[model samples]
Target chain A: MKTFRILGRNIRDSFRGVWRNLSLSLASISCITITLIVVSIAMILSANVNNFTSQIEKDVTIVVFLDQNIEEDDIDSLYYDIDTIQYVESITFKGKDEIAGEMMEASETYDSIMSNWTHEDNPLQDTYLVKVTDIDHIAEVAKEIGYLENVSVVKYGEGMVEELVSIFDMIKNVTIVIVIALILVTAFLIANTIKITIDSRRREIEIMRLVGASNINIKIPFIFEGLVLGVIGSIIPIIITCYGYAALYTRLHGQLFSSIIKLIVPEPFMYNVSLLLLVIGMVVGMVGSLRAVKKYLKI
Target chain B: MDQIRVQGVTHTYKSGVTALYDLDLTVEKGEFVFIIGSTGCGKSTLGKLLYRELKPTKGTILVGGINVGKIPNRKVYKIRRKMGVVFQDYKLLDKLTVYENVAFALEIFGLPKDEIHEKVVKALELVGLKNKLKMYPRELSGGEQQRVAIARAIVNGPKLLICDEPTGNLDPKTSMEVMTVLDEINKLGTTILMVTHDINIVDKMKKRTVLLNAGRVLKDYAEGEYTK
Candidate 1:
């Protein structure tokens, strides 16, 4: 079709424009790359904090101690009661004798003193170790269990909970603010690039209009130009990030990524997902430039 | 039938004084008409109205039976495709070769490549620029550049070709040469409407001359001579 030929001509023209305005094109791309890099870092840190917190929460368990004199029926009834609560993920019933024996085995700490106390003479109380559906609701759950009949004490990992939560909140806020600022910067930079390019070609655009070139035809080349610049910019950041992460990961864990500290122990998938920030950066650059051309060209 | 009509047209700039006032004129099909006026007169404004570039603050202009003033904004592009426009400045795309400039209009119409190449070659050859097909606009002499512009305009074989002071910036000898080409193109039956202040050139043609003074048609003379 004739439209195909025109599109081809415009593509070639746009390619030529990128080279002709070398300094402006470079400036625009650099602005985009820097903005993307900052955005990518924010993304990486956000993932890091999320992974770190979830790991801590999944590892920590709530321990609820019951009175030693509690009957088997009362224990079973309490178990059923706690099981029905929405947040109670799963519960493990540890008899006092089982707890004291496990404690003695864990203590290379006080083996001689701890071994002197037999399972029959165990001072450790019977406890229900509870896991929650999510870490954030642990305090409310602990309070509920503490008030239950026959429950002597309910211990939530309060200090760890506070630390993980504050870190998670901080990571989220910082990531959002940084990403917003970077996106705004990218948009401003790309818009100025398009505006400058259009300014230089004002005479040509007007003449094209004179010859009955529709606004759509006049702008296709410039939009293509912006796309080319954005794509190039995106590649630069990706290469640098790939190399940076590759090297850091090598020093930290393998050729692909340090998968484990020990050969047998595997790293989490979070590391792989973190590398996706580079892809996020690329998409950001591409979309940012496209938006710039769209806003100004207005076909 | 009149291929072009202007009725009660008046134009005033932001300065609040009329440039053209209550002008009325018509040109039949295949007519070669010249509009002549002094510097302060509305010769250029009338040319713009004919092409629908500047709408008269009050009046109506019709070209090829289309009421240009009442044309909807979206359809303006369709109306323009039916006409060729040339300017004294030549307005050539400096970046494009002479051949590409001529082909631009057909390309805008999304004509097939084979058709564009065939027509572009024909148009350039008609304007006597076939040898300079690869030459950029900046490389050509002023007269030659204007010829390229002419080549571009007629490439589409538009129903109406409106030229505003097509020779204003040229030397006397070059001006006459361009006029000869305009005359030659006219003989082929594409109606030519030219606006000029060049009374010397106007007197030499003496075809259908419409004399515009302060926006009104002061005279309409067939086989008309240049007049004060």
Candidate 2:
């Protein structure tokens, strides 16, 4: 019961402090809001970029075209051979006639040019559509599959896949660095703002100290004030990021990146990001105020 | 028994200036003692030492039979809780009402709401400012504000109240009013160690006086003894 009363008093004093130093409090809130917004936008962008990269990775498949003159009976052994290789997930065999028919159905130019060609005269070779367990190992799997008997070519857009993976890696690294730097900067700014508040109330704090207020009693309200500032600061950004991301996702769905690259659906993405922002805000606020109040709490 | 015992206490500031040297004094329980000295004569330093604000460089100060210098930092507040301190500037939170300012001391102890209210009103009533409960410090005169500070210091019912130049910022008339309040509080059996430069109050009141000069006691006089 006594603890509850102290906590209530701390909370009341915190709000009163906030109200008393309205301008400084607002300045701190704005700083937190702006910093969090930048962080949230970075988070949303990285989530979408991650979604797009993984999709691209999933779509990557090795195409193994067989020799045009290969024996019909040799295909079964070839399928068994490809299946045994490590990293080979699945392989689908397509005959030359099926390949030619797919080409004819895909375009009118191909249909007109291939209407007179029979399966015996088809220029297309038999092929295997091979999926690898991991996109990172796609190039190695393609190279290994090329050594198979009667295989003429193994193509999986190795250069494009490698570039895409490297680009995503760079983006991930840069995002981490940027996010960490922003968090530190935010903590520093909040700490300085709280330091100003402590400075302004030095006399009151001195009186409290002289009158026998414990160190914990003196520190609790300032910490509470910091937490309140952080929470208030995070609210605006959370609202902005959640609704802004949802809006961006809605307006640009399938229109900008198309099927090749896509934004993550907003439901779970925004929810997780919002939660992260709130946690960071609260933790930063607490830590900043805790640090700033230490120098003045010598009494 | 002595409520406070200073045994050869000496204090030296970090600037290499000696504020008090080999000073020994004692005040019995419920005694009202006046510490008189000119500026820079270590009067405030004695008041500070009594509250354990400045640990004596040479000897120990035992307050209520506990060695104040040997008390750990975490328990300093406990020792201070047994003593109230009033300052020259009133030190009232300008934004807080006279009532809130007085209640702040007990509030820090997490006293119950009704108890705080009752004690705050009682303390203010003693200071003759119960009618100015809702007024802010800025709204009150200098003397009234000092009374509120007094109310705050006494609200917790501290056994010893240390006032360091409590009237240094007020006029002579207001200073007398403030002194009268302190006198009334002292009559209620709270030991008071007041540091003052006002010779007029010192000579008029004729309480027990400890005169300090150059960080040492120049004279120790009994009740009704004037320094003139």
Give candidate 1 misplaced runs (Cα > 4 Å).
A2-6, A94-98, A114-119, A254-299
As a TM-score, model 1 comes out at 0.88
Give the worst 10-residue stretch by lDDT in candidate 2 chain A: A254-263
Interface RMSD of 1: 2.6
Q: Go through the candidates in order and give the C-alpha RMSD of each one to the true structure.
A: 3.9, 2.7
Best by TM-score: 2
Model 2 has an lDDT value of: 0.88
Candidate 1: residue B63 Cα off by (Å): 0.8
Write down the TM-score of every candidate. Answer: 0.88, 0.92
| Ten contiguous residues minimizing lDDT sum, candidate 1 chain A | A257-266
Go through the candidates in order and give each one's C-alpha lDDT: 0.77, 0.88
Candidate 1's displacement at residue A119, Å, is 4.2
